[model samples]
Target: MAVNVFASATEAGDTAVPLGGSGVAATVDCPDLSERLTTVPEQARPDVDTELARLDEQIAAAYRQLQEAARTADDAKLDEGAILDPLKKERAGTIERIAAVIGKAGKRPEGLDTLAECTLRRTEVATTDAPGGSPDQQRQQQNGKGEEPGNTGNTGNTGDDGDDGQTGDGQQPGNGGQAGNGPVAADYADINSVRPNVVQAPRQKNASTGSFATSCGVNAEGLFNSDNLIAAPGVSNGAHHFHDYVGNQANDAFSSDEDLAAAGTSCADQGDKSSYYWPVLRLQNGTVEQDAESPGGGIEGNAGEIVTPAEVTLRFEGNERGEVTEMPRLLRIITGDAKAFVNGDTNANASWSCTGFEDRQLKDKYPLCPSGSDVVRTFTFQSCWDGRNIDSANHRTHVAFAAADGTCPDGFRAIPRLVQRVVYDVDAPSLQDGGRTVPLFAVDSFPEQLHKPVTDHSDFINVFDEDLMREMADCINSGRECGPDTPPGSEPGQGENPQEQPTENPTKDPQEQPTENPDASDPPAERTATASAPAVPGQDGRDDGESEGKGGGSGAGRNDGQASAPPAQERDDDASPRAEPRAATTPADDTPDDASGAAPAPGATQGTGGGEDAAAGSATEPQATRGGLAETGSGLGLWPAAAGGVLFAGGCVLLIRSRRRSM
Candidate 1:
């Protein structure tokens, strides 16, 4: 029997097919191949081969089952009692521990895992290499684990464990760690550690000259001592103490040049500083008046040019009408030109040549006039003269001086003229005020022999008029006579009426209403009618009832009450009046008529109505009482009562309807 076996093409092609020889007969084609097989183990080797193939199939099925189990375990969702649960938990714990270690390290530590492995390997090596060590040594070698020498892997060397309880370099992780470090100190020690370059800052140059000696001889603390420094003359110390410069100079030298340059640039960018120069006008009279001018074509002595003072005269005049008119007054004299002298050579002997000429004809001739005289009186007078307009044509009238009234002689009058002349010299010190030069010079020297004695008068003489003084005294007396009793009009008490007894009736008397009806429902209306009544009750309670009678009783009271009631009814009937007038009259609106049909009893109604009318006449009647309760009840009056009731009831119905709709 021919057995058929499946084989690769290469093997199949290589299989030998025996050809039938001469002695063998050709066999028929076998259709039932299994029926032709040999039944013995040697004839068919199917058991061993089949058994091997079955085993291979079993192994493949087991591997597939194992793979399916792995996939299920890895699934995000799993049954509660799955066997992989503990293993999954252990894996997750390991991952979390690894993350925690990485987080604590901040940055990954290089070769950390390799170092740990090397350390464990070294421990293993130690355990194997050092067998007979002490218990401690053995424990150390084993790394606290009782494992075989070659089994354990390396763990890294001990390092600082961070705040997160993981091994890393010294610092803790995150912002919390930085805050926990606390504030850095600002002292030299701390600052040097952070910025060592700061200690290398150059020292500032000393600009002080030490003068004061301290207990330490010369205080080495000259940095803060202002007395140790000599400042240039004329330089301001800025304040009483000059020590402030020490700090300022130190800052200037130590601060960055960029900062100083920035400040300087800012200042320079602000442009020129504002200043003021007052216009000065030099006057020949020695008075520094504003806008005064020098005379043209006159004896010129450098009036406007800067020159040294040779001689100057100062004149003082007194108010002739005052008690001090006789006193010799000290005066200040100034001059524009300081180069022209009176005697040409007497610079030191200069004196007032016209001083005591008060008694001579010179006094009467040129009393107030300084021109055509040998010497001029010097005096300062504020003038609105302009220096640009002064010339020889205006010289005589340019300089003027003061004198006694009517002291001018026959044909003379006070006129302005040159007084003291100045002689210039470059060797002399320039005239200055404060620290600035005066810019103008005064003449030097004068003729001393020309001086004379000035007339003197008694200093105690009263120069004022006595009659004028008496008139002033009378005015003061008259002012003092005015008292609280004085009336506004010229006629003291006559213009004002005297206090009088209050009459039985005042002319502008308040109209009184008649007695109201005890049964009136609306007493306010009744009272109003009574107030308008023509007749009123008399003192005797008699009712004359006459139209002309001022007072009456019975009939008058009835008429007054009747008359008062209609106007009130008319007021109540008017709808528009009730709306605005009621609001104006009664703020609280608590009146009986304000409520719907809520009238008081007969007598109570009249009383209440009268009281309300009076309150309405005055200020502050209650209006709120009228509108508030009117919705719930009928009102007392005609139109207003009905209208208010309707409005209130309508408002209530609307509110109810709205509530129903909301519900």
Candidate 2:
């Protein structure tokens, strides 16, 4: 996203869309409900009430600091909006956290009225004294939108206009709970109670069971990003962070229509090349620079992209009854909201658990895997299709989940559900790597994430041809265990030796069909086999799509027949577990091993910002202090100029609009 110098300076009218719409941050604030709390006498509140009250004060304080920061930026008139961008984002997050806790403090008394959600009134300073600029040369002006959180009922905003903060009840009831934002801000009880309303009702179903799955390419060495999926519309590999892909060798952001036309695949079925990707989870050592933390760790700058996982397994879980009529040929999904880290619980669609740790299944915070257990990060995406539109306005409305009995809801049709399990073999700690213990905080898994910590999310784009997609749907509704070689729980030919990695090649179907390279090494035509079919609608905003409201943008990676049993779920592992083979994960090398490793994962390449450094992949490269951002030549540093232009413009418009109304 570059600065539109020409448009800002020469245009006769303000753009209907903000100039920096694609550039800087969002405002996530909700109307303040302080006065609403007056109804419940402080004395009658729960022990958590005092904490909520205190957080409110902090929210107010942060708002003030943000105001002060805006003033400082306005005074200097920095060219790039980068420096102040982060400060503003962080402050906004702090405010939202307070709001989530307040909202979760439970509803206020029936009539307790709170202060209308506090609005971060915009402020502007003249292009007064910008550095290195003469009076006439000062082109940059700073505009402040304050903090707005995403919409969450009546809650406050994060960096943009916040969502209504009301719970399923859509109201704070009566000072019954806190009244701010995010699930993280509230406790376990609240998180469960506020399961985001699945706007699309589950479609009804009669039978369950028919579905096919691809084998996981346990060989971490095979990971790479190549454009072979939904092309034309969405930018390929646009995720700012690196991604780890599993299915479909030739699938990525830049895939062309022809490429998707070819029926090549990485699934056990020869033609089921659906693409799946999520951010690469890196190890953060409190020790070195990159490994230590985002603004802190890593050797040269940060740490080299650490080693690939020891193993990966991909299998489809089917409904119990029988198969149905058909499945959506090409379905796409992105699991979780973008701001989970900052807002907490806002879209708590994440599940953290250990192989042998079922008792602590849905704990809010990631729990430690027992000594020999693997740290599993499981993400689920909604699969019920409206049967009419392949994609909905919000990327979710058209899709809903099937009931436990495997039936779709009233207006919805059941599609095969997609569940991804990202496993890390970190139980046997390696001091050589970053000092990260397994089961670390996910979401913003990076210790100091660009936005908020534990802000974990994932993206997908289906490039399957119509015929193959139809076949896949048939496989699902028909209850056929699609993969001929590897089915769920049955690792073909490896008879119960649970420890040894599967020797099965994921690049081939059960028939041993050769696959095109995922590293772009193969010739374009051959590698990106294409077909002439309708393109699948893009997923959530990891790339450029549309609005996230209504039925568009991605919704939370969704519901299982029912929410997983909460953390207290009862289950015991083997009294004493047996040792499993430890995967020899590659360690971060100080030297650049350009020749090693797979192609950089999606978005971690050049052009997208220098993100695809050999060091970032190749199992060894310069440790990047800034991770993907610095690699891409993108940092907050570039935004000041752009931010100045947009904010200045927004302020002017608001002021003009206000004056006109008054007249």
Candidate 3:
């Protein structure tokens, strides 16, 4: 099933369609059964997880089949025969297996077979033009008040200029890049033209303002896999898209919690064993990657040269409303929807922008940065955690997002939020020539996702030991900025500049530290000097010699016209590892909670908001404690509940005063 990495064209009825053109394409859309399994019994969790992953595999296979079908193919015939009907049967059997497992433990989920039937969803062809001009300019042009900007023209360039599909030697240009799959010319927009829509979340007086940065090299080790240990444990190729891993190295579909606990990390501080990974970004130039024949690669419609990030900054920031609690070890979290294209964007959380234009974020379109400006991908993870479970049956219920006002829901506690920023040095693709001049770049995604920018996402599994976790919490609560290069357990401003007083672990391996400099023997932890702004080359805090390419295997030596990522930039609201406390206007928390712990109906939005605000009580009390009181008071008589509330508030105040004095 390995696709020709350089496929120049796909059949389209009687005519032979040339490669790299835009038009409506059909994709498979099925109900997300995972979101509906809210309360699987603990004993059946493993079997249930495996079956859910099978559902994804079934859909992926159907999508690949759809790709083989020509555009002019009959939908009715295909649905009942070649595609939909077969997919439905497979899905039904899988659903039955899932139900059987749950039935062994508790009440079996019913009517899941009804979700087997899926349909082809038509996707609109994306625009490839780099639209320019300010929002004001756009408004004026719409009213015939002004002329459209020059960059705005030629947007309809179908990528089929005069060049023949075949090059002189009979090889397809760039090895049939773009693969007629996606990332059409319209998927990219000019960053300068985007209006500044980033709004920082308003911080309350009790906000935890401190920040901690982890210095995990930009995945220089090149650890990659298609398995999603969190979502699809024990299932191979569960993700069907390669993920570049940076923190914990012992991760795979079959990895156990014990394995992760004992594994090594790429992080400068070994104490932080958290795994941070996201889909790999590939250049659509015809060069075939090593994974071209693998399940997550060309076989899955993801082709081209894999690009290693020039800069990766993993920073943990404090809550805006109050102090953050330590994330329990092994707590699993997934941010952004990997299947957002078909999932309807209910959980899309990643943003795209350019290095210098971080203020302007794009949820759907990729940015066409000016020559010197590199493309940037930013992921802001959920910061609120339920005090109980490390993971829920649906994998989403244990965590939630803070409200627009920056308060965690009534029952969820605020935890340090992880903000990941990845940068790539790449030349803008030539939309006029359909990426023939400069190939397009896209993030790896499910075959059906069409490599859409909206589907970009990241994953995290917290593995910080208790001592390190407590230190992180204390640092944030005390308003101290700390980082991997900072001295272990150092106070504010003490190790801000590692160049001044360096901390060294004598027993650590020299190879553990990845540096841009080949000759320099120092590990990344010893060189905590501030790097220049991202706009400047060698911004990764290393000298020119240290800014060499980080990609290995097939990705190496492919830099003829490619750009290297500009190194580390100083921390800032937009460019640094520290996440800005910004109000998310995307209505990320609008989903309602399911009733009586039952899963929501298929296709219904899952609740992402922290539960309703805790009943009125001492502001400093634990969110869970306050929530419990609120629920209890609802059942008592009015007079008794009032008296209890007053007494509880007084007791909380007294307890807080006593604790503060002790401190």
Best by lDDT: 3
Instruction: TM-score each candidate.
Output: 0.11, 0.41, 0.68
C-alpha-based local distance difference test score of model 1: 0.17
lDDT of 2: 0.32
lDDT of 3 by residue, 445-487 (tens): 9888878887898999999888888888887776666665445
lDDT of 2 by residue, 491-540 (tens): 12121111122212223121121112223221111000000111111111
User: On TM-score, who's better, 2 or 3?
Assistant: 3
- Model 1 scores worst on lDDT over the 10 consecutive residues at 117-126
Q: Which stretches of candidate 3 lie over 4 Å from their true place?
A: 1-24, 71-80, 126-175, 488-663
The lDDT-based order of candidates, best leading, equals: 3, 2, 1
* Cα displacement (Å) at residue 247, model 3: 1.1
Consecutive 10-residue window with the lowest summed lDDT within model 2: 539-548
Local distance difference test, candidate 3: 0.59
Task: Give the whole-model CA lDDT for all candidates, comma-separated.
Answer: 0.17, 0.32, 0.59
Q: Can you rank all candidates by TM-score, best first? A: 3, 2, 1
* Candidate 1 regions with alpha-carbon error over 4 angstroms: 1-394, 397-406, 410-663
Residues 1-663 of candidate 1: C-alpha lDDT, one tens digit per residue: 012211222233422211111100111110111111212132122232232222222222222222234233332122322222332343334333333444454432232222111000000001113221112223344475452332221111110111121112322111111011100010001000110000000101210100000010111122221111111111221011111111112212123323322331101111111010001112122332211132110111112222212222111111111111111111111221111111111111111111111101111011110111112222122111222222112122222222212122233332211111111111111111100111111221011100111110000001112332232222222211111122222121110010111111133111121122222122111000010111111100000010011110111122121112211321222222112111000001121222221111111000001111221221111122224444423444466867889999999999999999999
